[model samples]
Target: MRTQVRVVSRWIGDEQGVTSIEYALLAAMFSVAVLGSVVTLKGSLGDAYEAVATAVTLAVTTAMALVS
Candidate 1:
């Protein structure tokens, strides 16, 4: 009974795994932030690409009409 109690006390006071748990939590938080940024940037980049495509199409149509 005494040995069991001593083991339990030692386990409760152990700090060996604390740093790994903290690092895991920090990594999860950083990943969430990065994912959020990427999602936002994805939408903005799509919009920019669409605008450029529309501009190019307009210019090509105008040039073709002039040629015809």
Candidate 2:
């Protein structure tokens, strides 16, 4: 019974896995932050890209008109 108690105490006192757990938590938080940012900016990014595409298309059309 004494040996079992000592083993249990030692196991409870072990710190080897603490760092790994902490790193995992940090990684999870970072992932959540990135995901949230992407979600929040999804519409804005789409609008920006669409505006750029429209501008490029208009420039190309104007250039072609000038060339012709």
Return the top candidate by TM-score.
2
User: Which digits, one per residue and each the tens of the lDDT, describe model 1 over residues 1-68?
Assistant: 99999999999999879988999999999999999999989989899999999999999999999999
Error of 2 at 60 (Å): 0.6
lDDT (0 to 1) per candidate:
0.96, 0.98
Clashes of each: 0, 0
Tens-place lDDT digits, model 2, residues 1-68: 99999999999999889988999999999999999999999999999999999999999999999999
- Model 2, C-alpha of 5: deviation from truth (Å): 10
Candidate 1 stretches with Cα past 4 Å from truth are 45-68
- Candidate 2 residue pairs in backbone clash: none
